[model samples]
Target chain A: MLKIFSTQLAGIFQNIEKSSEEAVEDAARLLAQSLVSDGTVYFHGTDEMMAVAYEGVTGPNAIPSSHFYDEKTALTAMDTVIVSARFAACEKSAAIAGAAREAGTRTIFIGAAEKGTDLDSLPYDVVLDTKAVRGLIPQDDGTRTALPSAICGLYVYQALHITVSEYLEEI
Target chain B: MLKIFSTQLAGIFQNIEKSSEEAVEDAARLLAQSLVSDGTVYFHGTDEMMAVAYEGVTGPNAIPSSHFYDEKTALTAMDTVIVSARFAACEKSAAIAGAAREAGTRTIFIGAAEKGTDLDSLPYDVVLDTKAVRGLIPQDDGTRTALPSAICGLYVYQALHITVSEYLEEI
Candidate 1:
């Protein structure tokens, strides 16, 4: 029983390593640097995905900085937009995408890759495909349940923030 | 200008001091220790309050010996329900609350005052009522906007967890 338990502990650590794929973290740094270098970072959240954004934004942990939203320099120059999967029903996301296009601002969507998706293809300077990371998980009850989505989403947030911090060093 | 800024910070700190309440924390501590000491602790969040829950629950940070919703325990002693205001519209929260009640478990609603709210007729568990936490700030342009609700909400969680940890010492 003792041997089994110890091996089980080691197995968990190995599984965690297998579960982690970080192709998007380095890309996220470029996106952050690009936005900060230019002007503003516009975050688009659908439903509760706002929590991920609230962490990166300055002032009031929940609400994004109004100053960043209001300033013209932030909007026109380096403003990078991040869209979340919760945008399935959120029309506001599409509006932001359209407005960004009209204004020539850069946009990134952490969403699906269905063919011909105009928003999906918008030269996403950094796309941390969270769903693809989820796909890499072994077929199991936990993955099908809320565990994978919940865990991976938080992991993506950490990866992106690390990339953003590195991006700041470049500037 | 600097003096004025110092005064604002002082006021914010004072506001938090005045509003800090702790009876709910005491109650929750006893509650968590009682259940967790035995076997498991179950949570059912209501409404938008689900956001508050996803963090301390099945997420990576919180390690539960076993997932509560995954199976049924035959002990019949497990009971403790955490309700939030946002649960009113959330079916998932409602279902969990219902399950706990049906299983002959105790329930606690960490939200605004209800009819049976005793010990302290507080709206929210001490911190929210006393915390400067998430008030709206007037913009220079004439509009008003909220800071961050989670920042304050997390403060409440911290206070509650501290008390709960102490309660565990007894069990």
Candidate 2:
């Protein structure tokens, strides 16, 4: 109960990004730059995507600094976008990201580029390649869950924060 | 970024009515309960309160199974609730929560409370009070941006999730 006052910083630091740490870091840098440039970042995800929007899982100091979804909160012309991607099969996000573009915000999609897929043409300025964990996917009460993918996506989000901070010209 | 997800978890873990750790265990339990009940937890937050609507700082694993904001989503009658409080001054939320209460969903508020404040007396079932970290006197940000009260509240929001999960008796 005390964490309502204390534990957030510790909890955020607890789960480290294993394999995809670098990609996440680079993504963070890009995001930070956009933020520093006065561009509010928008995070879009579908199905399990909305999950990322509720909290800023990868902000400096373990804070949920920026993750806009509300139309009222939408960034104006100068905003940048950062989105989480699992597989191309996550087509539900098309409308979501597309709508963001329509709102006059830029777009960036982060996910794995499954070999034959043509990822180079997307509107994203940076593509952070995060690979899936080879073996340990999460399953709760006999129900298989997409925890690994979701988990890694979050890490990339944080890494992007770092990268953004690193690239920030002033500080 | 990644912290948003962890922040969700951190908020849960931090806001438990029980001991900090026990609260996390309980919140995690509640998350499992939410899923098993076929209920999609509803998230409503605005401004700085977006932490409730999205992710937190990176590292920890705090991904929710599902959430709500869209009116068209499958949310209905007596599901669950998550709210953020800013000085307890809400107008729109009053109407929304009123309608939601009529629907029978349980509501939870993350805010500051005086020692005698009776959260149980309210329509909501739970209230995670961060004691609203107050400065001896209100100060301007130019003086310093350390509103420990708000930060504490954020941490509480981060903790409650863990407690709910722990309560549900699942992973």
Candidate 3:
């Protein structure tokens, strides 16, 4: 079962790498610009997705971010916020994206692009599809285990990190 | 590069699943017992690996844990501390693992078992190898990009989550 799941994940990541390459590069360009301009980059998300934000902030290009449960965090015009979500269909993510837009802050969203979801209407400047594979693994009770969004989000982050590094070097 | 990296990850995860099966299962059983007995499960780590702790606390069968940067948080005798580290060679992880052991709290570590490292001497009751694959991807500079420990740590968390859920059902 674990082997099957790992293989499925490898396939999912490859698909995402192909499909989201342009968007990921675009996001890295924007993020690199923000960092070079001395603007703070904030990462936000709920539940397990918060790990993406936490991981981003602690890495080499350290950014400022909010905690998973800290919904009261304020945004500023000079800030660039990256919001990661499993479905990108939740109220909290929408609220943050909406508020960031209103506050004249740039917003980049990374998550599953579920069809017919309100995420389409959110005011994000960039959207990197997490490409979550639903029903990826069939379980004993007839249900399927969806791939964890954190891994997908982290993969995207890795791409962004590499591109951002290259962009920084170019600048 | 991404495709090759993903394939390497799948193989690494499979190896971890096979080699660490008993230890992962053992940790799950202990964690399940703790949850059933109303004991708090605390996840801890530093830097990127901190995501593992945050991920563990936010998911279903949610546990109580401290943030990686919050070194002041106190633990109790009834608590269980799960520490995730890339190298497991840092002072903070060592300190936390040691303190938890002295406090009579069970400690479980998830990270690479670097040969000849102090990790072998840590006070963890169980150590699930993150099995970080060194030299997995060769760079232009002739250095290999070690597989990110965060991904391996998250994979272990997923395994533990599944096994714990099963154990919970049985109990």
Candidate 4:
């Protein structure tokens, strides 16, 4: 079962890499600008997606000048914010992205937005789709098993973190 | 670069699937016993590894009886606790596992324990190694990049969750 799951997960990862590479680079550039200007990079991950926020703000290779976004966070035009959630239409994540846009901050949204979803109208400056909207395995009752939304979110977070690190190194 | 990361991460996932399948099953069975007996299953994830804890406790498919482990959590022999960290030698995770063992509660450890590390002596009912101690990509300066410890931890958590769900369905 794990072997099958691994194969399916690899496909999910490949899909994200193929589709979201450019978006990741673009988000990195936006975040790099914040780092260059001494502006903080904030991460706001909704619910279980907070795993990505914790990685960006406090992981071993955490982005320099990063913070976990909170209600009291004061954003500025120079700052950048990354909002993550299981789905692109997450109201909580969209709220943060909207608020950041109002403050003139560059915003990035990382989540899976199915076709025809409201993601098309989100206020984020960049959207990196994780493409992990379903489970990997099927069950007897027709339901799915192994919904790894947080894992997918973290994979995208790793890519963004690496791209931002490369940008900072080039500077 | 993201493609390379995706490939390397797939390898990491495969490694965990190949080597830790039995351990995951054993841990799931242990956890299932607690669920069947009306004992709460606790997840204690250290630092960034808390992503796994959150997923197990409150994600879309949360365990039947699960909670986030805290210092104030009281354990009984009937209950089960799973401790996770980036490294097998994490002092904090070891502390929780130690306390759980002292209380006679079944314990499981999930993390990477490099060869010759003290992982051999960990007092836990089961240990599932994630094998994600190092970063995936190499840089021009000889240092590695894109360490996805939390991601790997979440993968293992997903596998365990699926196995436990299977057991519950069978019962």
In model 4, the runs with Cα more than 4 Å from the true position are: none
Please tell me which predicted candidate would have the highest TM-score against the true structure.
4
Docking class of 2: incorrect
Q: Which candidate is the best by DockQ?
A: 4
Native contacts retained, all candidates in order: 0.04, 0.11, 0.45, 0.64
Instruction: List runs of model 3 lying over 4 Å from the truth.
Output: A60-78, A133-136, B60-78, B133-137, B144-147
Sorting all predicted structures by TM-score, with the top scorer first, yields: 4, 3, 2, 1
Predicted model with the maximum lDDT = 4
* Residue-by-residue lDDT tens digits, candidate 4, A81-149: 999888898898888889988999999998887778965588888888888888888877898877778
| Residue B23 lDDT in candidate 1 | 55
Q: Name the candidate, 2 or 4, with the larger lDDT value.
A: 4
Please tell me what DockQ candidate 2 reaches. Answer: 0.16
**Every model's TM-score:** 0.40, 0.49, 0.86, 0.96
lDDT of 1 at B49: 39
How far does residue A6 in candidate 4 sit from its true spot (Å)?
Answer: 1.4
| Best-to-worst ranking by lDDT | 4, 3, 2, 1
Residues A1-171 of candidate 1: C-alpha lDDT, one tens digit per residue: 112322332333234334333545554654655555655566655434543444345323222231223224335535566665432323666666657756666666554333344544454544444442222222235542122232233335444544454455567
Q: For model 1 chain B, where is the 10-residue window of minimal lDDT? A: B121-130
TM-score of chain A of 1: 0.56
Give the per-residue lDDT digits (tens) of candidate 1, residues B1-171.
112322342354344334444554555554665457564555433323343354445342232432334335442445454544321233454455556656665544443222333523222222123132332444457854333233333334434444454455566
